[model samples]
Target: MPRSALPPLPPPAHLRPWLDDAVLRADRARFLTDLSRRSLGIGRLLLLWAVAAVFVLGWTFVGMAWMDVERHEFFSYVHGLIYTVLGVGVLIPAVFWLVRGIRQDRQVRQLLHAWVESDRDPAADARLRAPGLSLVWLLASFALGVLGLWVAFGAAASAGPSRTTSGELAYIMGTGQILWITGLLGLAKAVVHYRWAVRAFRSRN
Candidate 1:
């Protein structure tokens, strides 16, 4: 059998010094590069993008509560409290992960830059480019946006304006809006990643 392409992962943490040595840093960067490739692989990335919809779902309830408050509806305060609780439950983790990802990306870039400059590792550059991942992101984002549009607008079109109750209409509208906006977010993410990948490829060449 052929040998594995990736470098072995760094040793157990207890073996490292107070600050990372060059070997440790390069090994860690290589490990993270491998992880990034796995996470951004087509099927896995698509699923990860789909999970982003939960953010829209949480915000939908918050919007519903806001509308209720604005209209002075009977359940305004109670629904607002309940919706706020539910939204917060979802949002806290969402925010946590968002912040974590940002920090991780920064650290990964810093380590990768140092490793590449010092070691002249070509595999790291290739992995960072992530050849097909950007195309997958673009395709997935487009598909998601199309689905969102159908969900958000199809309800009214099918039910007709006069047939649906206010609550029913609101529910459908909110769900649809969530899907549509989530798709937009996915598209934005795709664009950003694609641009970054393009730059990575150019830098490699």
Candidate 2:
């Protein structure tokens, strides 16, 4: 096929990064290192969440230990209410994300579309990758928030006769509603991550 006979497609100058070749560069070490950096931001968010949850549980347990058994249940209700309010009653803890995801997810899908079929137009693909990257950031935020909430429950779950340290039982919403909700949020993030992966592949290629 003569170059002159072919129809002009999209330019390939700017869009190469988001495309597959740039991302999965044959240099395995660089590829893994790059991927780690890209994914680490989200991991830190999760770690922060874990740290915060620990503080909350610790404070609550210390306060409860000072009180008698009769007063313990009060803290239980109090703890429950705190998390419920924070999470908007647990049942629909991810309500905001559900709403946000619908729009964001659509944008991501559209991004995938443009990248995959843009006729090599790098600018259009670049625009799509922007939304995809933003979506990854959003997922990271959600994961961090949920991870922090779970840390408290995880701490409580580890509590035993030797570990309870007294007053700690009250902090153990073993069925830590908030932690479970947080897990759900992380699960949602996985879906978003998958979408970004798809979009990233197209942009790189």
Candidate 3:
């Protein structure tokens, strides 16, 4: 090939000045909007934020009861109940959602990969390959949840009317309650679990 026969670089298309500026502005705006979703994702890393409110409510009741300055006072006992309920209410669901949801999500992802039934079973669809939660795991959750509730009851009883209390204990009680409620959900699954457990007996019947 001769030097004079060399292909020249294609000139860039000339966009209208205002149109080019608009395109650039639009691109920048889109980039920012996309980043916003990722920025907001940081909060999801700490689901405890939702549980924080109940902690405050629980601590408040304990502090108020502690201020009553009475021994074996009925009012103080009732005051303790306020924190106890608030703690249990928040804890039960928070713990259930947080631990079980997170755990099941992880396990399913793992099982989805390891599932060999797809190869051997003709009926194995994508749904069958999908990982399912085990009753055993759910039972464990219920046990833990009940244990958490027990702790909350203890916290409530300890924050007596005569004792000086602070609002910070709400977090502890809230967490304890979370464990209990989540566990309850796990335990509640026992209805279905027992069905399978007694399947051998039911089959005979």
Clashes of each: 0, 10, 6
Cα lDDT tens digits, model 3, 41-119, are 2232233334434444544554444444234578767766665666567556655765754564344333332322112
- Who wins the lDDT comparison? 1
Q: Provide the global lDDT of candidate 2 against the true structure.
A: 0.47
- Candidate 3 wrong stretches, greater than 4 Å: 1-135, 161-166, 196-205
Ranked by lDDT from best down, the candidates are: 1, 2, 3
Comparison by TM-score, 1 against 3, better one: 1
Q: After superposition, how far is residue 174 of candidate 1 from its true place, in Å?
A: 2.9
**Candidate 3 residue pairs in backbone clash:** 91-177, 91-178, 92-181, 142-183, 145-179, 145-180
* Cα lDDT of model 2 by residue, 108-132, tens digit: 4444333344344344334333344
For TM-score, the strongest prediction is 1
Task: Indicate the residue-level lDDT of 191 in model 2.
Answer: 58
CA lDDT of 130 in candidate 3? 16
Q: Write the per-residue lDDT of candidate 1 for residues 65-166, one digit (tens) a residue.
A: 665665566778788778878887886786676566556545545444444444345555566665466667667767877886787688767775467655
| TM-score, per-candidate, Cα-based | 0.57, 0.33, 0.32
- How much does candidate 3 score in TM-score? 0.32
RMSD of each predicted structure: 7.6, 12.9, 18.6
What local lDDT score does residue 171 receive in model 3, on the 0 to 100 scale? 43
